[model samples]
Target: METLTNDKATLEVQLSTQQKLIANMREELGICKEHKAMAESQSESRGAHLLELKAQLEDAVLSLEAAERRMHDGELMRRRLHNTIQELKGNIRVFCRVRPMSSLEQVGADPDIQPALDFPPSDDLLSAGIILSAPSRDGAATLSKHVFAFDRVFTPEASQDAVFEEISELVQSALDGHKVCIFAYGQTGSGKTFTMLGSEEQPGMIPRSMRQIFESSQGLRQQGWELSLQASMLEIYNEEYKDLLSSKKLSGSNKSTKEGFGSQQPSGEIKKHQVVHNPDGSTTVSELTVVDITQASQVDLLLAQAMEKRSVGCTALNEQSSRSHMVFTLRLEGVNEAKGKRVSGVLNLIDLAGSERVKDSGAAGLRMKEAQAINTSLSALGDVIVALGNKQPHIPFRNSKLTYLLQPCLGGDAKTLMFVNVAPNIQFAGESLCSLRFAAKVNACEINHRKKG
Candidate 1:
């Protein structure tokens, strides 16, 4: 009986051990279920965050596109408004500039020589009018005052930057698809060339204008503007048009002839060029050299080349006087492929020959002939301006090569600005008066409204 009781106790111990193992397994299964639920919740949260990020990215992309579109529209509006402002100022304008006397001129100057030119004290009048006091021809001590007004006037103290500020708007017009003409007019030694083709230390209108165009074009690239410029330079010498950029070398005799004011006959034959007026109101010269201007520096190169080849001669009034009217034409062709728009414009920068009289210039023989030709062309230009100012039915554009070539700028839908450069010296008082009067006439003349092409 004792052996049977011991066996029953061992059986009971084995049963208790198996029940403890079952309880441990159930606890492990419950913990695994809780971990699975937490994992599922984390996955859902991660997916929601991803979707939110995607939506934000999409919103940012849409905003960028909208801003770009607005930028493009704003650029277009800017062009139109800028052009409108220019028109309101005037389609035709004139600015008078008086250059200071040279050091050589100041030496041994007469103490009795009083100041001939005076500026008004008022800021408004200072830029618009100049007073000239000259001694009467009767040899009296009395002074005759002549008051003249113009669109703008620059005194001797004005900087080149200051002068260009007033005309920068006109240069912008050329880029906006309007024909622009800016020319310097004055007698010899009166700073016309200095104003137009200033020294490297002090760049003039042509270089400054080119730099402005380049800078502006680069800025407009973001708005989808692509502008290409073509430049051509020519000179009208003694009623004859000569391409200043011609590759043909001028014969030694030809050079001598020009130096002596045509005292010797030219052995080399000069190519004849014809100016053709297109049905579209564009003027082109036959066989003219047209160079593609990719950079503003190219213009400087061209100016240097032209100056070397241009017709210059010695005269009594001024040595190395420009004996020809130099015309530099920059043709701008721009397109915005994105907007499906295109434009064509031209900028004509002319440096007219000095308008001094033959007697004053002390020219004889062939030189006299050259002076007469220059005077005739200038007279023709004056006549054309007078006709335009009167709004006549017929303008005499064909009266001279200079007038005919500038027909579009003077009479067509173009913006024209004349710089009447003058000398601030008692000796040049008469010439200064004449230039101011002529500039006044030009400022009064009006042309057709500008239409963008």
Candidate 2:
């Protein structure tokens, strides 16, 4: 009976335990439903937040692009403004010097030239000799009251510094890739040559200018200046252009060959009728002296050779008409070692043949022809200068060989300077006035400066 009671109690305990477990399971199911709902709500919030973040990122990207665009535009505008300022710069610089007069026979002489001081060397180079020293111990006295006294006394060896300063600035422009020009003017026997090309022993502007460039280049080597140089020389004779330094052909070339007229396209460019082409497909150009000179001595050699081959003949008005215009050009093709790009600049040293009176020259035949050509070309040059000064619509650069050759100086990107040589002689009064007027006009011309290869 006792065993039956114990078994009944055990069955009751098992049934209570099962009922507690069912209760606990029901509460857990309700809690799970609440958790699921909260999870759905959080997901929706997260999706909205994600969309906002994407929008912000897109706005940031757009802002960055806009900033870059603005930066590029500002750079472009700044470049334009800088170029405009350079364009407004004027080119004309005129300096007048009344020359001191001394008989060519009285002053220090031309070293490389001799025999006849007034005449150029005949096939015999020494036949024409130069005056060695001042005849009078008081050289200044001979120079003071002489007709050219104003030029000689007022103008000194130091005067070229001013000119070099101007040209030096031009060179800086060229180093930045600008073109430049320098021209000298005076009446026949007025010392234009002296100002442009000093004595052989004491070379003038051209040589000195070249030296300055070389020295400056060396100093600026660290700044990245790489230079390439070329030189060309030509003359306007009898309305005909001649290459004074071109090697003569012993077999086929003759006087006609030297006399042949053709326009020179110096270097390759978009040259039109302004520069004529050679029919031979070759020019006096092929005969050019192309040398790379690192040392100043190398340049000296070239100047010496050029002087010997120079077309110098004696005339009544002056010893040498410069029979040909000698243009000693320095083409500096520099690559900024710093910039890693190329730049080009040119220095033109022009010693123009002074205007002369045929009556004064007492020339004949070929000489007469040279005189007429010189006079005619000079007249045309004067007319062109007047037109340029007036800013007239038409500038007759092609009117004369001299003027035409100078198109680059007057019409192109160049810093131009003209030296007006005057004489103390009362006979030269008219010449002085004309030269001054021409200088004033040249100073007025506005040239277009543009960078080209």
Provide the global lDDT of candidate 1 against the true structure: 0.80
- Provide the TM-score for each candidate, comma-separated: 0.83, 0.59
Model 2, 110: alpha-carbon shift in Å?
26
Tens digit of per-residue lDDT, candidate 1, span 1-453 = 888888888888887787787788788878887888888888888889889989989999999889878887787798889988777666777788989889998895787878889988555632387888766779887878888777788999999999999899989889988889898998988998888889999999999999999999987786788998888888999888887766564432222111001222244555466676777767756546667789999999999999999988899989988988999888888899977999888889999998887767898987787788887888898788768766799899999999998887775557888899888887777777777777776776655542211
lDDT for model 2 comes to 0.56
- By how many angstroms RMSD does model 2 differ from the true structure? 14.6
The TM-score of candidate 1 is 0.83
lDDT of 2 at 163: 49
